[model samples]
Target chain A: MTSVRQRLVPYWLLAPGLIWLIVFFVIPMYYMGELSLKTGSIDTGYQLTWAFSNYTDAISQYSTQFFRAFYYAGVATLLCLLIGYPLAYAIAFKAGRWKNLMLFAVVAPFFTTYLIRTIAWKTILDDSSPVVSFLKTIHLVPQDGRVLATSAAVIAGLTYNFLPFMVLPLFAALERVDIRLLEAGKDLYASATQTFLRITLPITMPGIVAGVLLTFIPASGDYVNATFLGGTNQAMIGNVIQSKYLVVRDYSEAAALSFTLMAIILVALIVYIKFAGTEALMGDEEEAE
Target chain B: MEGSSDLPPTDPESDQPGETAGNTARSGSGGVRLEGVTKKFGDFAAVHDMDLDIADGEFFTMLGPSGCGKTTTLRMIAGFEQPTTGKVLIDGSDVAGLPAYKRPTNTVFQSYALFPHMTLEENVGFGLKRQKVPKAEIKKRVAGELERVGLSREAKRKPNQLSGGQQQRVALARALVNLPKVLLLDEPLGALDLKLRKGLQVQLKEIQRDVGITFVYVTHDQEEALTMSDRIAVMNEGMIEQCADPETVYDRPSTTFVAGFIGVSNLMPAVAKGPGEIEIADGPTVPTADAAQFSSGEKCFAVVRPEKLTVSLPENAPGDQPGIDGIVESSLYLGTSTQMAIKVADDVNMTVLVPNASEDARQHLPGGGAKVRLNWLPEHMHLVAESDPGGSDADQTSTDQVTEGVNS
Candidate 1:
């Protein structure tokens, strides 16, 4: 009896988290799957008649919005990587006594609400604002052009909002890299640039993969940035799904579109993880030795 | 073995093959040289004005305790840290401005800093790859190095997958594959267990002999230094106390610091009496070698190895030998020998080691509180220079300097 109770202690410890996940994730996913295949208007009450055409119709009507969403998100993720990596590296390796202060500065903007921050970008990128006027003077923007509502504005906003997600993980990875390994690289005849490329970059790859995922996934599903900064021509799949649920009252199409977007992202994630080997995720296992 | 072919052909004269005759004019050898080298972190000097000359194919060791500047000297030779005011030369040429990568020296780091993500093959081949060696040659040399270190079967495995000893061997093969002019090892086996360290010590000496490269090793282990080094430089407080062969260093330590640091020695405070005698404080006058170096009434230490002293009953003690009477304070059974602490004076204690060669020897050994006479030949006693009055203060500051070196 004692041994049986001892064996059951682990399951007792696991109960709360398992129950929470099943209740919040599993049940909602099942309902969403059911609603995706139903056919009905909001007034008529949906019926699960296995209308597979709902998915095909949603894909055909909104393919352009889907492509734009992925494109914007991909560009934003790349921009975040370019801007965040050096900042994190400097903090981790070179900022002797000021490392904590710089790291706090990296996440300082989060004190403001995300919606308010995105709204603030609107005033900064206004037509006659100092930023746009300076760009116009430098011929980066034409004399008659504006910066308030464009694909660039949406990308810029997405990059700014998700940059900390890229930096913190990168800082963690770069900090764990042993200084002696860099010394060994130099002792083995690797130049400074070669040392960075061959040793530092490969070791920090897990952080890069994580940063890409964190920045790309949310940027793809976000409609707030597009709503505030992008014009009608830049409407992403997120904007279409928002209108499909609220304005059109097309419950079945919205559910199908959500499932479609999830399936594509899942496939893309699988392919990305395949190319970037799963060994990186398992790489943390061997460091303790 | 095919692995041995990759080693530089042993030129008994110079060790290196491409050196021109004119290049060896200044140093008269193809190895490393340091002239007036000093490394200071802010105001504290980690390595004081140091001068060293390591010959080709010599297995030299810098032995000292922690914070004794041995590692700092090794770093200066490896070009990791530049000397503040001196020149570091490799193979008879001044490499003052050369970076670590461009210098003809390599270091096996104390931590065995293997590239964790890379396989053993890649780790060993990294230097050759940086040198732009052809792919086929790189593969051949990498396999040769892995086989040389007995890690050929695990070439595809990463460092974390290997044991500590195996990772250390991989680190060795990685640096040796480059065929550097001088190989610097900063306490490479300092992390291993005792038995493993002993095994690797012999193996490392054999490898140095086979490669015939100048090896400058740094270690805090005195026994390891004695076992492997062709010559040992015993250092303390940012300066070398003595640099000599192992036997000379053991038999005749020049200073009290060297005598105490190298092995167990009973150093008794004494005042020089004449040309061949020193009077022990609160005890008897003893005959000593090199007593002529000190003036009468000069304060010094009379040093004797513990193994050189014999204990016997007062009646059985030899009449011709110098002897001191003491009471045994404690006895430790050390398997091969019985070590006893003898109280010779109120404040001075002397250690004596008696070999346990027979059952009768162990049975006759004195216990605690037993009175015994310690006897030794006159030649066994050595008089060392007096220790510094501010020695404890210097030790305290050197430790602080070491911490500062680590932080910087």
Candidate 2:
């Protein structure tokens, strides 16, 4: 009886967290999925019709917006990589005694409200602002220029917001590098550049994948940067969902689009796991051991 | 210093003795020379003015306790960590500011650090690929290296798929593929269990012999150092206490740290009684070793190796021979020999080793305070300062303090 009770104890311990996940995640996803099959109008309360064309209609109407969001997110993720990889490498391998300090600095901006931080960037991009004036001096900003409501600004915003996410994963990947492998590469008559390309870059692919996943998914979902900095031409997928629910008063369309986004994300994750190997993406201890 | 740069490494049957000497001064023996090398991290010195010459093809082992300077010395030689106050020369060239990749040394780290994504061949070929060697040449060299390390069949396997020993061999082959003048191994076999460790010890020695490359091996395991290295540099407290051939290091330690650290010894305090004689207690004069090396009134320690001390009954003993009285507290049959802990005087106990020969009487030794005599040859008695066992009390306690904690 005691042994049976011991087995039951694990379930008892796990009960609360499991219950929380089901209620918050599973039920909400199920309901949202169901609601996507229903129609919602300003005159009528939500009602289920099992009309699957709502998904088709949502896709057809917002195809341009959905594809544009993915393209922009992809570009933003690439920019994050271009900037983050070297920074992460520098911090991971070259910082030495200052490594902890560099890591802390990379993560420091996260301590504040992200919304407030993005707003500050909005202020800094104002035409009359000091940053704009300085950029103009450097020929980076044109006279009478306004960065807000521009597509470039939105990309810049997305890149900035996700830079830390990309850098952290890249740093983690690079830091786990066995110092000996680098030495081995050097010994094999590998020049320093060759070592980085053949050894360092390939080894950090998992980190690159993780960083892209983090940057792209969040950038695609982020309407804040679009609303604050991106113009009408630069509106993303998040904006499409928002407008569907508020302007068109189409809850079903919005629901359908949300599920569509979730599906694409899932597909991307599956593809990444397939190619990158699920083993490479596991926890550090698992990989190290 | 000694071997060809191009041909594959092999353990030549005729080269065994000279292989041990590693006098390959054709590249001429100046593989890594440290002159007063010291490394200080803040106020704590990891290596203190470490001066040593590692020959081009010498398989030298730097050995010590965990916090000692062995790893630091290896790092200095590899150009990973810079010495705060000295020069590190590689291949007779002062590479004081050279980065690790720029140095003529390659390291096989404790963790093999194999590239997880690459196959064994690709991993071995990585350095060559980096140097922009033709892919065909890279393939050929990688094949040769993999063959050398006994991993030719597993060249398609990733490091994760290989066994630990296989992974270690792969790491070795990867470094050797580069043809570094100096190959530094930093406790490379530490992670292996005892049986596997012993196997690798033989393999490493054989590989060093074959390659004829200067190998600077760092380890805390004295047995590994003694077995694999041409010379063992026993280090403690950021300094090389003694660097010599294994037998000389074990048989004639210059300091108490080297004596205790390398092998077992009974460190006992003895008063200097007279010339060529020292009193070890309320006892007859034990033959002295170099009384001139010590003042007659000063305190010094008398050392007796367990194997050197013969345990015999008083009646059966040589009539004129002098010895200590003791009772065998306990005895253990260790396959080849019997080892006994004998209570000599008061609570002080001395260990004695007896060969397991049938002619050697397996006298059932008496326990606790049973009278017995311990005798050894006159020249076997070695003397050093009395404080050698515990070292300087201040330094000992501070080491204890460092181990127990750090401010950080």
Candidate 3:
């Protein structure tokens, strides 16, 4: 009896999380799937009519927004990686006694509300602001060009908002690297750049994959940055979904769009994992052991 | 200086007997030389004003307790660390501005530091690949090196898949594949269990002989150093206390630190009276071999090895021999010998080791709380300089402090 109880212990331990996922995730997903296949409007009572055209209609109508959303999020994720990698490396290896202080500074923006922080960028990038004037002087922006409400502002906002997600995982991976391995690389006739490429970069690959997923997934589905910092030209699929659900009250169209976005993301993630290798994710678990 | 010269010719096939001498001034002889090398980290000096020469194909060991600057000295040779104000010469050429990647030296780290992401073959072939050796040549050499270390079957395995001893062997192959002029090993077998360490010690010595490369090894284990080294440089407090062959280092330690650090020695506080005599503190005046080296009334230690002294009942002690009377406090039976702790003076405790040849010998041995007399020949007592600060007590407490400093 005791042996049997011991075998069931893992299931018992997993009970709470399994229950939470079933209630919050699986049930909502089922309703959303049903709602996507219905013929629905606010004035007329909604009915599940198995209308699969709702998905095709939503995709055809807002294909431009879908493309814009993916493009902006992809560019933002790349920018975050380029900026955050060095910052994380510095904090992990070179900060010395100042490591904790620098890490705190990286996370300090979290103390303020996310919406407020995005609005603050609006003022900083205004046409009359010093930032725009400096950019104008440097010829980065033309004398008449303004930064606010453009694609640049929306992309910059997404990059800044999701940067910490990139940095923290990279920092964790870099910190776990034994410093002796770097020294060994040098001893084995590898130049500093070669060591970074062959040793440090490969060891920290799991962190890169995780950071990309964390930043890209939410940024693609986000409407706030586009609503505040972008004009109609910069609006993404998120904005279309918001307008369909709230302004137009086209429930079936909104549900269809949401399902389409999720399915696309799933397929993209599968292809990515296939290319990058599932071993990268498994590497993190081996390190823990 | 005397210790090094007195060493028996280690390699009978070698041409010169004095080739291992540190002061020979044979520069550019395809070996390593450190002249006035000192390393200071802020206000703390890790190594200070060290001058050493390791001959080509000689297995030299830097043996010391922790925090004794052996690793720092090895790092300077490997070009991982630049000396504050000295030159590091390898194969007769000054390598001051050169980085480690360009230096003709490789190091086996204490932790084995194998690339976790790469297979065993990839890890061993890393240096050759960096040197741009041809692809076929890399594969051939990597396979040969792995087979040499008995790890060829596991070439496809990552480092985490192998055992610790196997990982250590892979680390050795990784460095040796480069065929460096000088190979620096920082306690490579330190993490292994005792039995495994002993086996690897013999294997490492054989490998050194086969390769004929200048091997500069660093370790805290005295037995390992004595077993493998052609000559051992015993260091303490950022400096070398003595450098000599294993026999000379064990039998004739020049300083109190070397005597205590290398083996268990009874350093009884004594005052030199005149030629061939010294008065032990609160004990008898005994005959010493090197009393002429000290002035009259000079303070020193009457150093004697534990196995040199024979213990017997006070009544059965020899009448003609000069000896000390003490009370045996305890006797512990070691596998091959019985060790007795005898109190000679009010404060001085001496250790005596008696061989357990047979059951009859064991029956004749003294037990705890028995009055006894310890006897040894006049030549067994060696007079050494007074123990210097931070050099005297080679006990567990100081060992712990040194271990902590090195780890931190």
Which prediction has the highest lDDT against the true structure? 3
Which residues of candidate 1, in runs, are more than 4 Å off? A285-289, B1-29, B389-408
Residue pairs with clashing backbones, model 2:
A187-B178, A188-B178, B1-B24, B25-B28, B25-B29
Query: Over the stretch A145-215, how does candidate 1's per-residue lDDT look in tens digits?
Result: 88877999999999999999999989988998988999999988899999999999999988898899999
Quote each prediction's TM-score.
Answer: 0.93, 0.82, 0.92
Q: lDDT of all predictions, in order shown? A: 0.84, 0.77, 0.85
TM-score of chain B of 1: 0.88
Off by over 4 Å in 2: A1-40, A44-56, A86-119, A133-139, A171-200, A272-277, A283-289, B1-31, B131-134, B271-276, B288-299, B320-322, B327-333, B343-348, B358-360, B384-408
lDDT of 2 by residue, B1-408 (tens): 121311223446422322332233324333678999899999999998888987778989998888887888888777768899999888888998777767777788788877777889987876666657788877877777777665676789777776677778788877777677888898998876666677678777877776688999999877777888889998887888889999877777666676666655465666787688787765566776656677787777677777898887777776555577777787766656677778776645676778777733765554455677888887777776532334653234433432232221
lDDT computed for candidate 2:
0.77
List the lowest-lDDT window of 10 residues for candidate 1 chain B. B20-29
Q: B109-225, model 3: which lDDT tens digit per residue?
A: 999999999999999999999999999988987887776676666899888877778889899989988788888999999998776787678778877777778899999988789
Question: Between prediction 1 and prediction 3, which has the larger DockQ?
Answer: 1
Model 1, span B1-408: residue lDDT tens: 342322333444423322321122122225888899999989989899999888887899999878889999998888788999988888999999788999888889899999988989999999999999999988987777776676777889888877777778889989988888888999999887766777678778877777778899999877789999999998887888899999888888887777767776577788999888889888788787779999999998887888999999888889889889999998877777787889888866787878899978799888899988998899888888854533444334433433332243
**Candidate of highest DockQ:** 1
Record all residue pairs in model 3 with backbone atoms less than 3 Å apart, i.e. clashing. Answer: none
lDDT of 1: 0.84
